[model samples]
Target: MIRNTDLYTIAQSGLRASNTLLDTTGHNIANVNTEGYVRERTTFVTQLYGGVGRGTTERVINTFAQNQLRRDITEVGEHEIYSQRTSTVDNLFASEANSISKALSRFYASIQTATDEPTNMAARQLVLGEANSLVGQVGTMSEFLKTKEEELNLELESTINRANSLIESIAKLNDKIRVLEANNSYEEPGALKNERDKAIRDLAEIMSIETRQSGNDDGITMVNLTSGESLVLEDGTFNLFGLNGNPDIQYKNLELRSTGKPTSLRLAEVDVGGKMGGLFRYRSEVLDPARRELGQIALSMAAAMNEQNRLGMDYDQQLGSNIFQLPTVSGLNYAANSSLALTANARVSEDGARDLTSADYQVTIDAVTPGAPPTLDVTVALLNPDGSPVTDTAGTPITQTYTGLTAQAGTFEKVLGGIEIEFPDGAGYAVGDQFLFQPTKDAAADLEVQMTRPEDIALASPFRVDASINNFGDAELVSTTVTNTVVDNTAPFDPDTSAFDGAGGIQGPGVAPGGLVGAPASVVFTSATSYEVRDSANNVIVTVAGATDLNNLLQQAKGAPGYPAAWTALNDYPGYDFSLQGVPKAGDTFNISYNTDGLNDNRNGLELANLQNKDVVLSSNNGTTSRFSFQEKYANIVSDIGEKAAVADISLKAAEAMKDQSKNWFESVSGVSLDEEAANLVRYQQTYAASARVLTTAQTLFDTILGAVR
Candidate 1:
């Protein structure tokens, strides 16, 4: 049996241990409602029983579960951060697409106006003004995107700083937990643990974190989240990382105070499939690519259109001038032809003279090469001065054939041969009529020519004319005509009849007009007319009929034809397609060619048709192909963003639900009820009283025994 004194001591110790257990239970109940507080319990063990000894109880609690809860909280927080960022980016993409659409509408409207009134100065100005507006719009949008990116960067930086601060706070909490656990303190620092948990939750929103358990020298345990190779160790230390232009997040490769080698933490290396990861991916991949695509579209449009407009025949008929103002960026070279000269003229006669009635000639450019000689066809209507079709002296109407010609260089050139004429009776004559050509094959040569007639003398005044002509050697007599004769030399000259006919006048039949004496009958003369040669746009390049030699006119008209080589040189840019597949890159160019029809009005039809069919293809340096249109690609981008935003919204809602469910579960397991805590507090207080009474009774017994021994 146990000794009375030992038994009393054992019972006293047992009573004290029971009261302490009740007090701990009361403390747990009190803090159950507190945030970040982990529910703790005392672990009891029996004290060893030896000779004359009784057993006592001991208690312990598991802290590992509490640490794990903190880590989970961090993960959820990080996910929410990324989700919010994605939402913001998606909205930006949608807004940008809307702006692009509006600008495109304005641009198309301007084009319609130009088509409606080709010659209206106000309409042309409006077209140019609208073009400017479109360019400005594109530029403004691009700048805005850049600005948004900058703002995102700033936000990312701020987040990183906050995360670092939280990490440091968590480390400090770990130190406190270890110290308290080792000392076997009766009271747990519930408030400090809660604060640390909250800090960890906030940190998780910025980046994913992994945790580990650590033991201190006094058999006390604590937890720490791992950041790269270093522990967010419980010693108040932290590791910070950042990203540059890329989306990859890098943590500082920190060396332990004792270790020399460095270890790094990469967000990519960790399995961080959360909102943080999404933000990084968007900034690095999506946003950058979108910006580049926009730049490419702008550059491509400005360069190609400007180049084509440069080659186009403008209202002034000049070449190499842009119809639209092109956007320019730093470090980019944009050389577009903006000069265009287009013009119109009334018809003229084939004899190189303007006749209101008989000489109706329609001048047109038959064909054009981007940088080569063009084909010009001039159709002349041979008619009498009375506007009636002219007939030859053989009682047949006079007819002439003219071939549309080309010039090798420039719009003007010297004619190398005379005009070939076809007449009745299988006879043909090559007349040296100095004619002025309006539109020319080449733009750089003289299209104008001048002509002079040979002098003539009559047979009746042969002696005086011959003597005077010989004396005045500047005049060389070619032929003589006798219009009035009737076998008497007293007949009047007939103005209505041909001089070649006996009833008419002298120099009849084969004689040219104006080659007669005394104004006898009617005659045709070899006269010259001059005119200025212009381009398709009507800008005067040179004069045609001003040439001294009549043969020069024919030679210049039939000069070598030019080929369309310059127009095909615009395929160097990436995504440049004769078919529209991808956005155009910088340096892309295009050309416009006249239709095979004799009219220049339908020249732009082919280009417009090509554009409509989406035949332009986009090429890349990697030899990849993409079928993207300016409008369609942008629209797709907007649609994709909207879809993502919708998905994120759904996900966020789901996450909130999940969070609510978790909170309910947590509350059920570790929630504080005021009634429950109050009841426990009252029970513990009574237990304290009972233990005190037992101690008092034991004290009285010990005192009585001591008195007996005395």
Candidate 2:
């Protein structure tokens, strides 16, 4: 073992190892600024026979740091997308010129001007012009919002395709690495692994994914979605398909499927935490809700204007018709519904005038009777936004039973918002049938001005109260207001409507009659504290007593419980009320009749103008209520969207900070360091020189020994 030839071999191995080490250090310095290049290292081990052995090149990759970077990078992607998208929506709502609040304010202001001057054509035309302006503004905003939705779909589609391509790329890289490693004695090239990691990191920008290296095939990484669905194997990709969305087809639903698998799954019903998830979250939280809230305010405004106008008389001496055409919505059948013949038709409640909301609801049908029944009862319950049953404050599901519902033979059998269950004879509604009700979705876009001319504006009250001059004793009229008046309308003014609840629920007809019943009547005061309401027959029909003054007597007349049947009937008829101020002697008569020639009466116009401040929008059946005017509701939308935008911005900044920190951590472990590489290069250069000296010495010794042998 101590021979000169052994020394030569030893010197040769040392020179070879030193030269390889210098080459590896130079390579590290050369690729120090390269993208996706991990620092390469080699181990020099001494064999049992004392010669140096070169080990395989390995990458100094910190797996935990790499994974943490991917996670933080996905969060950055999600919040960046969310904040950017939410800012756009926020600006749309916050802008004063484009906001619904400004338009609604101007529209109501014009109505107030018209109310002050009922006979002025200029004022009436101003109202019409402002209404048209409001309608145009809302229409433009609605179309813009619709286009945003379309753009969102396209963005999502492009993102999905881009993600699928990256996944495929990663899978191919996996295959290449596996093949190369298998052919190279199971030692993968560090550069090839670098490329695979880059692909997965790129995929993380699109969506959150879990990755694990499989030791079975020389450490190939397997990728999966947040749903735990396998996305990438060692050599193949599980791609996603963009299918039509349920309830809304303009959007798309993601379907994840393996390359060779027959089955597929919806790529997560919950948040997946990336750009796609950000878009989806924005749609539900900001876009759809804000759009619906705007529509709701507009719809409520239109309904109030139309209904109030219909309650009065126009300049043409006819009952005022609707000022705006109301928007209508139909119930959308859920994809899981099995009733092919049944149709769940829907509309706004009370003919689009009262008790309407902007919330998306899921209507579930609970069939209380079998298909074969003389009386088939079905209860429709509106559930939460995501189609779960609504719970009460006490955490109990508040169930209201709709009993004694006899099935009729028409399109309106078992009706709720005109839901038709026209099955064959003796067939009833299917149990568990569900429908999605976006009642105010298209309300703003579909709103139209129905009033054609200035004279169509109803400004004159339908009734007039006149104090008689014959036997009155200084009893003065303080105020006279036509609170309610029976006019010729297309439909009867029944509070219950004798019509099914159009909010996708069923109830029986109310005890009150459908049509308002009253005739022309008069109230005659017999004393300062007593009055008798007589029909047009001039005979006393309603007698009231036990009042200290005329105002108190009027107050007593308002309540229907303690009063006689004739008193209640007479007071309710004509739907008018009056108050007196001073004292009055006996036999003070007030005549109430139709105001046939009251062309300049602006009382009803003032009443309609009062609707501007009415607390009427976004109604619910809860005991506690908080209603708002039109502008307030629109402002609420702006505030809500702005809040979401602010939150997203804050979250985005935080995520980006975490992402940078993780990147730094990964870089510190696996990234190339020029200083370290330069030091190694110098050390290896010294070793190379020393080994060369040894070879030279061994060569000189061998030559000397050869000379001596000769």
Candidate of highest TM-score: 2
lDDT of 1 by residue, 359-421 (tens): 211222323332233333323333321123434345454343344344332222112111111
Q: Which lDDT value does model 1 have at 79?
A: 48
Q: Could you tell me the TM-score of candidate 2? A: 0.84
Write one digit per residue (lDDT tens) for candidate 2, span 20-102. 77877877888888888888787777866766765566788888999999999889988898899899989888887797777
lDDT of each: 0.39, 0.70
Relative to the unseen true structure, what is the Cα RMSD of model 1?
26.5
Per-prediction TM-score to the true structure, in the order listed: 0.53, 0.84
Residue runs of model 1 more than 4 Å from their true location after superposition = 1-33, 49-75, 93-97, 176-194, 215-238, 245-275, 323-602, 605-624, 670-676, 699-710
Each prediction's total of clashing residue pairs, residues at least 3 apart in sequence or on different chains, is: 80, 0
TM-score (C-alpha) between model 1 and the true structure: 0.53
